[model samples]
Target chain A: MKAEAGCRACRGSCCGNPLVAELRGIPCNRRILLVGNPNVGKSVLFTRLTGVHAISSNYPGTTVGFSEGRLAFGNSCFHLIDVPGAYTLDPTNEAEDVARRIVDEGAEAVIVVLDSTALERNLYLALQVLERGLPVVVALNMVDEARHKGIAVDASALAEALGVPVVPTVAVTGQGINELVRALEERTRRAAPEAHSPAETTPPATLRSAEERWLVIGSVIQRVQRVTHRHHTWRDKLEDASVDRIWGGLIALAVILGSYSAIRLLGEGLIDHLLDPLANRLLLPLLEKLSAALGGEGLLHHILIGRLVDGAIDFEQSFGMLTTGLYVEFVMVLPYVTAFYTVLSFLEDFGYLPRLAVFFDALLHRLGLHGFAIIPTLLGLGCNVPGILATRVLESPRERFIAATLISVAVPCAGLQAMAVGVLGDLGGRYVLIPYAVLAVSWVILGRILHLVLPGYSPELIVEIPPYRLPSPSGLLLKLWFRIKGFLLEATPLVLGGVLLVNLLTMAGIVQAAARLTAPLFQGVLGLPPEAAGPLLLGILRKDVAVGMLVPLGLSPQQLVVAVVTLAMTFPCIATFIVLWRELGGRRLAASMGIMFFTAFAAGGLLHALFSLVGR
Target chain B: MGRQSSNFNPEQENLFRRTDSEEEALSNPAASEPPHPRQEAGGLRCPLRDVPNGRRVRVVSLPRGESGARLEALGIRPGKIVTKLSGMPFSGPVALELDGRQIAVGHGVSRAILVEEVPEP
Candidate 1:
């Protein structure tokens, strides 16, 4: 299952059969596995074919698990499995191996999705899949992209040469989905023939080598494909230079920063002016009355109503289930998450991410990582767990280590971002620049230092730059919807449960006791109050709780920045830490945590000292 | 086909299986050296040896991708010479200019891609 160098003899795992155990309970529906390289439209087609909800984002590594759903074509029902995108069957990493194993285990059939625009590269995988002698139907995706680029494909001719079905599809719009479903039906009706047929059960003496596979593909392509002359697109020449040039990098960086800022401003403005009023003015009052009727003082009441003090809902300490946690997460965090994902999906689907990666590759290389590492680093803006997990794409352990370290130490998650934008914008509109400056400086310094200190070789960049295509609106919307739903669910339960837990801890006087116990550390070392320790403790649970805790302390703009920055860099929320522990192992995780804790304190102390120096 | 290493994994063995009857056909030593159908460029000469690294040469031809026509249409087929602009220090990737277009190709892929040196103006 390992892909060693120059191992041409190794047929990829995608082109092999494993085994499948029949389920004794439910009727084993027609199981189809969607397998292909990363960034191909596998997830989109999976969603279209089976109507399954899989997160289909622009960057790689969004769909990390095998999601299952059903597709009903007429009276027939087929169960579909959407797997992680993989490059080669050689199983280079964990995710690739997961996909390999899924294919090895029997499925009714597999749809080898190929991007028509990158036909040759895409065909490499398709040829490998076909050699497996599995019941595979080639889903030639992005045909529209190809046509837009002046490449025309003869589907029937390709099908004839491949000795299997070839279905052209535009998964983003659900185009050719019915035809794909029909192709799958045809495959299932054939009952997945064994190798024992006239195809020779004993296996051939000389299997098709990689070169021969390409030759066969070339011949088939020669018969079925034609291209009319189109003027060379600007993207072809400008793409590499845009990110590769010095000035282009600066411009790209500015564009990225400006886009993020605009998204935040527009997102917050809409939510604050529109969504918040709906949630706060309409929803909260009704929820409070309902909790009142449910006997507003017991466990359920505390869980639902929170600590009601002096009348109106105290956005903070209203530590009730339905009132505080749900409201804060959904009303405050969800809208912004939705907006961020919408913008992210467009950037991803349009094929700009690779260029951005190319732009940042040189800078990242200084930190012992390549440009591909930008995927995880950007995701870290939203959350660290996925960011850490996304590091699986990094080829070297050293690059992953540095990437994980930098993200944990500097990158602020979405929740922290929301809090920063809200509080800092209100206090001193320009004060927001302070955190950005601090983070950027810290990132550069730390990244440079890590580049020197980290022990690993950074591989040279050779990434495939996909051509730009106009992103499908439905595709982008569906992607945004999927991620936003996941965020709400993941955050809502944790936030509400965290609120309840914090409430219980307060009622039992543990918050006071713990706050007192950590008083010296919070006050002397970090120069924040002991009460801030409570929020710091809750910050480990959910950043929202930590930011919520900050409200009571009533700190100045400088103090707020210090506390927020410290909290952000100190320790990620419990979930993220667990992922770090899993990815880096306990020892590395402990070391990372220890390094982060000290850095957070030292950094806060330094910032405080500098502010005082300027003040005098 | 190049000779594979004797150490084959079980998974790989399963993929490139050999049948008893077909083994006899493969036993002929001459069968091992498959025909190279690609038209070798130049007259009164064998395959060029020791094409120095970083030689500014245009690619006279290219080994196309899985879809050969698309690569051919990109002006990458025969007679479209390329220049070797740079290469990694330890015989790694070589950057080349072909038909006024530049691409970085790996050493293995580059070596197979036959190139005639571009004469200096």
Candidate 2:
């Protein structure tokens, strides 16, 4: 009942606190858990069974939290929970801890998804799950990949050895899914009559040490698995080269540059060819008519269409809920977000991110973080919210704090980056690189400082580099759509509200008052006009709009660079601020905010002084 | 236990033979008293970080505590054969090929892992 309560609470959200389950009541038999080692297609199998997309990817720790869904089989529906992948029941990390807790809380049955290619290693966890004495049907996933690798697994032999039904499956192709579900249905049915009787079922075996479990797994593998020598395919060779010291570095460089170019090309193409045209032709006339119908002069008109520039609406400069709000969110920011998630989804499903992490581990260590921190940092480049959320993968609180803080301070989301490029592109290529260079330098230096000052040690990277797989185009599109939909849902209201707030504040003359109050810091210290304070203040709500606001001010290139850098390093946009609070909690959030403000002003003042000395 | 016996390919006979010797050494330390000349050439246990790339070696001992348990869960316990793939520059994590899977262990953890090279014929 406690586990059921936990599942109920986490029905929509993917995460549930283990402590809440501990304080509750008895266990029920309606909940079946899908468990496996990391990156072994458990999530995919979950999707196959329940038709719920659990966001499967080709790397470890993708499901840092659990997701629950329902499986209806033969008129008997059961609650299916997709547990985070764990190598062992013995907790090693947060994800593993959650997995262990869910299993310990008891379930009706467990579906252990094992990788057929690496049966021996995978069997350790399977055997551990078997020892729990719960009914289990093993789904041997990725049989196709195993066959390609020259690994053969006799499903019947494995079933007999483990005394549980085993179904060979390829989750991506939907092969053998019906058989897997049928096997699960039969297994759970047979176990149901006495499932509630503790006396009828064998009690769970006492905890076995890692060595003892492996010994059992070894013998089990000897009976049912075989590996034959096979020539290395091109995929294998590419996988090897991607992790090689020299080639890995070169490939990493190319991948980074290539991804950047692709995102820019796709983003700008979307704007120029699709979104911009649709907006100007379709949406502009509607807005103009609305502007006229509202008399285009009162406070309400001002709030809706903003001020008319030369008797017409300038989408960028018109600070209205409808004029600038929709333009910034839909035309400017969404294109880049779409481009970013597309590329990132491909890289994730291709298993390239872990290699990138491995390649950068050494350098990241100096920053008081390990290589896995790179994943979160990469996610931060797309959006700071997911980047901060991905910090759950890191083991230690110290590493999470450091990574989250560094991301909030240094990493500019796609929206901010696109706006920065848009504003600075006209100045020159070199001017565009200024904020990037400053952020990069600060990333390293700030990490070094955090590493030295943080009392606890940052754990070293210990991660599996999954073999490369060709990502399915359908899967890539699904993930891209999922992320884009999430962005539109979360960002639309905030952008519109931000514009409305700006209009209301400006009308109330509060903007002028705040600008005057911060004039000393803006004018005397950062060498910017006080009017710049409004945009900088607006940066906290929506960064891209804040940066876009600067276009109308006509600031010199140097002043624009200073303001952009300060805005980036200062308070993260409110979405990121809330996520930071949730992830780091209140105390560390305060500390992180402190670090942010200090870094923003320090970097801003320093860059301002440097620019003045160079006579820019 | 019994070396898993899953590798039936003839090309891996040499690897099985090496595992036999390693098992013998583990079971009867005195019987292996007169160390093979190849073993002498390979030297005694050294940190895994110093092992040459592509050299097949047995993990002698892992760093104690949670890190050791973590490695063991991935099939890198003592006596398990693993090949050093490559180490990153500037003392980065070392990549090891274990049972057809690549695992990256941090430099510090790799240094604490004691290993001895398996002689090549």
Candidate 3:
């Protein structure tokens, strides 16, 4: 079923011209694709044209999936497909393959976006698209930056050189979009001229030698661009250190540690100052009131606000879907997720991700993975669902499987980590570090094991390091808003649904049956009680609530560490489970889960045994 | 794709290192009559992996198919000047700068590439 779905999705994409058009609300059946080299603001263009929030960043390989939106300009609106960025139609990577396939399927016309700063290199893609004989319009994006760098591109001269219409605009600011639309409209009008008039527009120099293309580009650049000497700037100095062998690694480390500390500080502060007061003082009473209004001892009341402590609301230990689930999703997970992605967005916008990829290139290479794995790993630190989605940036399936598996088992998402800190911090700070320590060592060992077992090697890193820019504040906030919105959308329903499911099962005696079945393993292997099984079971749903489940169990410090570690390492939450099932097929997902269980049990048992030995 | 192999053999160091007088002599054929010792080194072909850091080399050839095609699209081709930046410890991959762009070349692909040292200005 999984493989069939994968094939159908590919076919939909490969032959996806009309279908994709209709889905994005074209209605007229006319579609246009936005194509360009990676990281050149094609997504920003998509958002500008269609108003869809496609994530845009300064680094390459961000747009791995093709997004769609509708443009209602004039009486005629066409579906616009934001094709993933590729260098040429001759594809090397999976993302590039998708880009080439979209172009081959044909569109009414193509709007090829080019980075004005790198005109010649960016034009290489444009020339290939023009050779395909589609009506073309050129968008010279980032023109402001080009001018700032003492480089000027004569837009009219470039249009004359390429025999196409060129519109110079900043996609970020929606500048020149109207001019671009005008050029596009003209191309469409010229494409289907009269009833009997065939061959409306001729293909531009269909087959040219690479040498010939270079000659044309060279001449065109000479005519259009005027570069003047400039003094070295601060941006240039930072760009140098970002890729320097020694300093590069240090800067990456500093950025990572700083972000981690910030996430903890900020996440904890919000919960302590904002969320705790709101939940404890205001929201908890409202929920308890609802519980009482619905017959305080009834199942609905029990499910919503579980038995209150001493006739008052207890936020953490309530086990109520309304209380803990909502609190965990909004207050705990959201804050850390927001803090994490804020720093991540800054790094991505500042063009530091590619540099970090370069720094980890060697380390990942040794584990049969490439450097790009760092992106998914970093995202995993925030949430596992997006991390699994981000694995598409990697070029190979072998690397994707290993990366997804390692992330699910070892990387505790911020949702789970914040709860762990809250529950374990009460015992002592040292106990809080245990789960993370266990995660770090398990990642290396499990990675080595996966490397030894998995067949085939990951592709070598061959990525471009985009230059640094002072990230625009508006862009940063827009990107962050979409990300947090996405988190809330995915996190809320699944967490609430999971709580409901667990409550129903507990009422039906099913939870008792399952807990009895796993009792011996829970007691003998992990040194935890039979009732601890419920949180372990629901850990697959919402990890934060699962960690909170441990608080009411009154387990010692060592046992608390064992249970949290086991919960984190066993499997990702249901949202991530679905995403992994989609990304990797059923068979690979099963193998991954099998490995997770084996490792979780083995590590849990080992920790329990060692800690017991020390206690004696 | 067809690749044109250079006739020159690569020289590690020695007479090839100091070629200013020789280049100047070559400009005037009459003064370059001392039997051009470095003439044979002009066609100096070697794998990109062997190119020393800070030395510029022009791409001489590449194997055909995906690898060659990808390199070409990325602006790495015959006569393109590339300067070595940093190489991985185990002949893994070499970081190179060409056309003011930085890219990492893998172990196998870089080995398949044959280049000759470009003379400095």
Candidate 4:
């Protein structure tokens, strides 16, 4: 009954018991977990084994939580769970806490993924897991990289040292995966008899401390790993230069400028040459026929084709579920999303982000955050959902709150950025920079304020700066595909629904009344028309659609800047709001929203006053 | 592991010398005792922050708290050899190499990690 209850609760997704599987008419699965240190390519190994793509990166903490998938081999199936990377089982942070809990909860077998390049340090964790008495198959991952660095790890020696099977693997390619699976099969099969004899593997009454573990690990490493002198390659030079005090700063600046140019060039090219023509030549004609078939002016036509502006469909201004919704999501936003992720994924896979974090540490500390917060903030620029989720990598609750709040309020997602550019770019290139400038100022001011007000000290940066491996083209494309797929799935329906809701509200006369009620705030304080209220309201659901709504309002470029800035500072889109709540909980979420409202209004009013004084 | 007491520079030693009470306040009982014997024997000892870039040093002791434990977990424990690679100005993080891996430790954390220079082999 208890198993059935759990089965029902999870909808049979996580239930691994044979009886429960039989009752549900599904084959029983053996639970095998993959565990490793940060940046050890465990996620890649998980993907290889299960054929499920988990977002793998060159930096640490890419996976802040676990992901589950099923791997079928020979006859039996494996419910493979990729646990968050941990340096040790003795929990030092949240990720390690999750890892420790999962290991304690028990699995049919565990696969301890060891980085071949860092064998001595990696062995500390492997030994900890072995002391827990779990049946573990050691996956010596990244063997090729180790060899490239002139570090050789003897797999049989390592296995013999630990009394476990060690399979060397290069996860990026498919090398050694088949052998890994076979070794896993052999280990798990032998686990049956081993599980019955707890006395043999259970840790001693006097558990070893960290220093003691290191002592044992040192002996083990001496026998298994050999490091020889190697010539200094270009990669070594680049790595040194990247972290050099003067050179690191210069390189960081170059990276920022280069990334901006690349994103703009690629995004604009895609829109002009590809998506825009497709929408006009292919979709516009099809929509026109649908409009005419609907008798040119009805509820369906208004909702679907929207109002024809002077007998032509205006994709930007149309408040139709089909017209603006599809256009904004696919044409206006998707290209920018694609371009941004392409650049970000490359940086992630190239192992450059951690070095950037190092360069920014001193500056970030002034705002009560350490350098690692930049990862989440950078991610927020892509989309706030994962950005907020990545806050789990921060050590303290205070840091997570500050980081999440700052991300939601100051960091505009790619969708919002795309629409802002679309609306403001026509005014002038300079006009496009206004909202970004204001957002950057607000980010610093708000971060300082939060740091002053929040209790508890933020932990210092203790991140591993991974070696600069040339990013694999296939890995880059795969990661980009996963992010783009996520964007399409989460944004498509929301954009359509937001448009339909706007139409329905307009049809019911609610928009006019709401706009009227907010007239003084929009007209007097923010220097915008009363109709700006509608888009601001829509901004809560989808910021891109909200910015799109502003195009039809015909505000001046100054007012457009004011509106865009306010919209960005206000409530994040529904998806981000939900994630923030889940991450920050009710009390902190409320505090975060309160800050959002205050900042949005104050910034909007101040910008309005400044523009008015300047006579722009 | 050989001692090189003659390498001590009195001027540099004065830069890092701390009051006995301050050392006591920062020390954790659970960790090993302060490396006073090395200091008294005239070896050059200082916080990790004071170490010059590209110098190899052995960790002496860590501060008392989570950061120290975390540093240890990341292979910066006492008796380990680490090379100070780069340190940013304005109290930024110090990038160091341990066991052929690069690690960045923040300003406050670096200040609490005590290290002594290792004479070239």
Candidate 5:
């Protein structure tokens, strides 16, 4: 998948589904690609056109973020693909390659979404699209922002000049979206007739020289755009400060630490003020009543509501498919996942991520990864699957392996962290932080080792730092909704299934045999209990639930901390493992897992010795 | 993003480091000979990487192929005036302003690109 990610359409293995290369298939749908420069609201326009929920980020590259939506207009449905934004069709990057492929692969009509404010530069890409001789329409988007910047674009003049329909649109507000759709339908209909016409009538023009294209663009911009204001605004000041030497560093730090603290605070508060009271106080009593009503002892009661702690419900330790599973998933993990993605949504839309990536490029380079490599690692904090998939943004395989290995082995996703915090936070905040410290140190160490061993070149970063924007509240909420919804949709069943599997394993006595098999190693090297064996095995299925399993073992704070770090380091979850397999292929996946296991055991043993020596 | 061309392989750097003395002897047969440094970037033609930050330069030539063609299409061809912006201190991407937009190019492509420094007001 990693090899093919760059040229997926070129690989003719799956000819049955033409749309497979772009995104998911939409049955009986003609293709309509949303192509434009980065951060130009192409994804927002995609959502507005199709009402398909593809949350757009304001950052330059989001690794696995193309969407195919079913758009029905006037008894015709088309698959609207939101390809990654590119500056030009000449591919400078992987995303750009995907964009060029989608356009070159013969879409019915291509909608060139251009920023009205940056018309001159946007015209470079737009003119290239026009020269392709495909049915085309230009969506002169962000006109409202352009107007705020004292710029007004004449859509009619642009339409007449380009010889295609141009719809002036504010994609975020859905302004002129209907008109844009109407224009698209009419233009696409006009395309079929034009295709049959003489080649001389609308011949594919020779590729224009850069100077010639700029000359044409200059005249077009002069004709259509009217600049009313010459003075700089607060937005300009903010943009400058956000990238300034001292202030930019400070701002980047503030953005990272501030958002991190904000997420943690929000998640803890939700669990405390909302989810916990509902779970422990309200739901616990009711669930206990149900357990009692089911006679409270046999397989049904055990599977549904595991053994209670002192006749009271303990969500983490209960080990039930229903009781603890629901609480751990909804009450514990969901809050952190919700809060992290909420803040991430704001950062993405604020266009702060790329700037942050730029700011950290040099530092990341020392760690054997590109500056843009930070995106995948950071995204992995939200969830490892998408984070691993996001490695597609990196060009080469070695960088992906290094980033993926570090992420899987060190970075704990929100689910895992939430569980770690919930369990460890009870002991002390200091104790709760120990695993993260271990991971942070491990990130640099493992990265250096991987750099030494990995047999390929790491790609360098060449990314655009998108101009910053003040995120609209509605846009923030919409993005947050999509992320939270995705988490709920994906994690709920997996949590349930993981819990069911663990419980089934215990019932079959497989866990005992596994525990006895690993007991010598766990007890002697790690100074951990044999019961630690079960959670470590299940950690491969779901790290969050596995961490929850630690609560029942009644280990010391230091022991629990060691166990948490071990679990996080051992392996990515089954879903993430599959994605890693797809991305790194079979051989690389096996190598990484080998590294993961060796690291986990060695780290666990080292921590045990450290704890013993320090008497923690 | 840059014109990598698969020129640099990962194993070469480590292998070169391990056999550094042997390679030096092989390349320069006379161990006692006074080494004379070659004058590269001697005159008007220099790679973009060697250009100091804040220096405005005109694009002179780019490597031929898809990357070159694409770079040209984006208004970053010969005779276009561009200003080098902030370059990350290490061997990182060099930022340039061209066609009135800031673009970051990786060091590899910057090395491939030849530029002539120009004075700007």
Candidate 6:
């Protein structure tokens, strides 16, 4: 059945207008439909309601549709269907179309989940839904936050005016859950209506036009809402200034820089104190014993077990199962990955990001992008996979290419940065600043260049600034678990495999041959020893291993900075390459990869020549 | 009715509390009287723009500005009244709405408009 639809923004684009296609039948038993704006609380609510037995997520453009499950409310069982979120009934993106389809077809009832703080923005969509005339219940979620912000509403008055139940809820905490169930039960108890619904509840004579609806909304808000408080605290004022003014950008930058330093310091220290010991003292010993008992000598020993001629854990190279992958995955990489995600999540949960977007907006605009691009760029620091995927939030393909290129080139993934600090930190604590400076300058300069070359208008810097609060510990920790688990599953395997592959390539004499061929450029242009070629080539696998190998060569601080920059700008690691290929498409991917190779060499050569001229 | 995409993750309780219905539904009953859904308040209501200078009257409905398309979709249509929820000390965003939905407009956007508070029912 066609649902009531009236969104002022869309102006009858949803159910308020005529349908372009024929109405379809609802052939299923459980008639549940999901609703909300994109990136609000829909998916989380869907997951919580449906459990783990459904198609929770899917790749974009895929033909696979909504997921369904059964939910029991009181004495009744209903089918719960999770559709995509849309701004209004108006479908702009692929996800919106999915939501549109569900509503156009029949559903028993629709629950409109509105974000509490951004109520005005959300209500635009709600109005469209209410116009459809389906059984409607307003799930007034996030009530606690509204009160905290000194905003109050009158639900009873709202229900009375709208002619539907209004349920206040904190879905995450499951507050008002029983009431929601009762409301749903009340909605379902009514006899099934005729298959299709009328376009409007009343004839055109009595129907309210767009102007009348706003007038009605205004009057209802006036009657129901009471302002109990008049003043905001100082902290809220500071945030308003930071997000609203030109100076806001600078403040955001300072906050981001402070966050980065804090994360690095805390993450590195925690790994050193707790995780490193567990890996070294416990996991490594167990793995070594397991491998030995499996096979200590012979050919099976050669590939899998490795030879243990002496008592020194003797292995030809670190690539054997016992030697490389196991160590890299469990020991060298896991501690740092765990630490990185925990810190990253804390900042995200604290709501410091959108403010940073304000700061980055101008700079990004210069680079033919907008401030929101910073989100993916920041994510790139952890791993390029999600970073590339997140570029979907950007508007155009050209922006995506530039963002991907900049991220792959200038942004240092956790593994690379950790390795850089680990390798050169002991030589001089001050050396850490060099990579940061180089990256900062390169990103700025490269972004400027890309802006001049790329085509498209950078989107505006409009962002929602969530009020600051102490993050929920349980929620934050759960978020951390998801992030860290993704790292362990995706990055750890690559690091392990990359380390072993490099080790095997070196052992097989291929790396030596490659290094020999690049010896002249390595020595004459980059001013590094020819042996550095092997690790630089191997850097694509996992950056830390490349840096670890560099320890044996003993490069000076100046040389270290150049080497690190070159390594970072060179080909992205195997994982990132996969993402780049997916995001950039075949042609652009190849082009960017080619540019990266040349840039790495050219920049390193230029820096080397300059440094030598200055008597370094 | 058109369905709202339940896409938001309200993992934190506060995020869900700020919506119009939730804010009104969850208010402390002791602070004021229990809600009367359909009454038109005729008592003095504070106009946010007028503040101390303006006369108090019950909110009747939202005034539709030139951007006719968007405000309508926002559930900000007529017949419902609004009260000035809060004008923060620093004069940033002001929260107000029609029906149960809320809107927090920046000071610049809010100042251009006028509001008349309706008396309590």
lDDT of 4 by residue, A462-503 (tens): 988899988889889989998999999999989999999999
For each candidate, give its TM-score against the true structure: 0.76, 0.90, 0.86, 0.92, 0.85, 0.70
Compare the candidates by TM-score and give the number of the best one: 4
Q: What alpha-carbon RMSD in Å does predicted model 6 have with respect to the real structure?
A: 12.3
- Put down candidate 2 lDDT per residue, A1-616, tens digits, no spaces: 1223333434444323322332223245767889999999988877777666778888899898787766656545567788898988888888999999888888878899999887888888887887777788899999999988899999998887777788999999889888987887788778453433232112365556666777777777787888999998898788778888899889999999999999999999999999999989999999999999998789998988988999998888877888888999899899999999999999999999999998788778778778989999999999999999999999888889999999999999999998898889889999889999999999988988887677656656789889898999988888888899889998898889888898889889999999999999889989999999999999999999899888889899999999999999998999999999999999999999999999999999999999999896
- In angstroms, the error of model 1 at A515 is 1.7
What order do you get sorting by TM-score, best first?
4, 2, 3, 5, 1, 6
Q: In model 5, where do residues sit more than 4 Å from their true spots?
A: A1-29, A63-65, A150-152, A191-229, B1-121
lDDT of 4 at A165: 81
Name the weakest run of 10 consecutive residues (lDDT summed) in model 1 chain A: A1-10
Most accurate candidate by lDDT:
4
lDDT-best of 1 and 2? 2
Mind giving the per-residue lDDT tens digits that candidate 5 earns over A108-152? 888899988778778888888877877778899989888877888
lDDT of 2 by residue, B1-44 (tens): 22322211223423223321233223433222354455556667
Candidate 4 pairs with clashing backbones: none
| DockQ winner between candidates 4 and 6 | 4
Clashes of 6: 91
lDDT of each: 0.65, 0.83, 0.76, 0.83, 0.75, 0.59
* Shift in Å, residue A145, candidate 1: 2.1
User: What is the per-candidate TM-score for chain B?
Assistant: 0.46, 0.64, 0.64, 0.70, 0.63, 0.42
- Measured by DockQ, the strongest candidate is 4
Q: Positional deviation of A573 in candidate 6, in angstroms?
A: 2.7
**Residue B11, model 4, lDDT:** 34
How close is chain A of candidate 4 to the true chain A, as a TM-score?
0.94
Q: Which 10-residue window in model 6 chain A sums to the lowest lDDT?
A: A55-64
TM-score of chain A of each: 0.85, 0.94, 0.92, 0.94, 0.91, 0.79
**Cα RMSDs, all models:** 10.9, 8.1, 8.6, 6.5, 7.6, 12.3
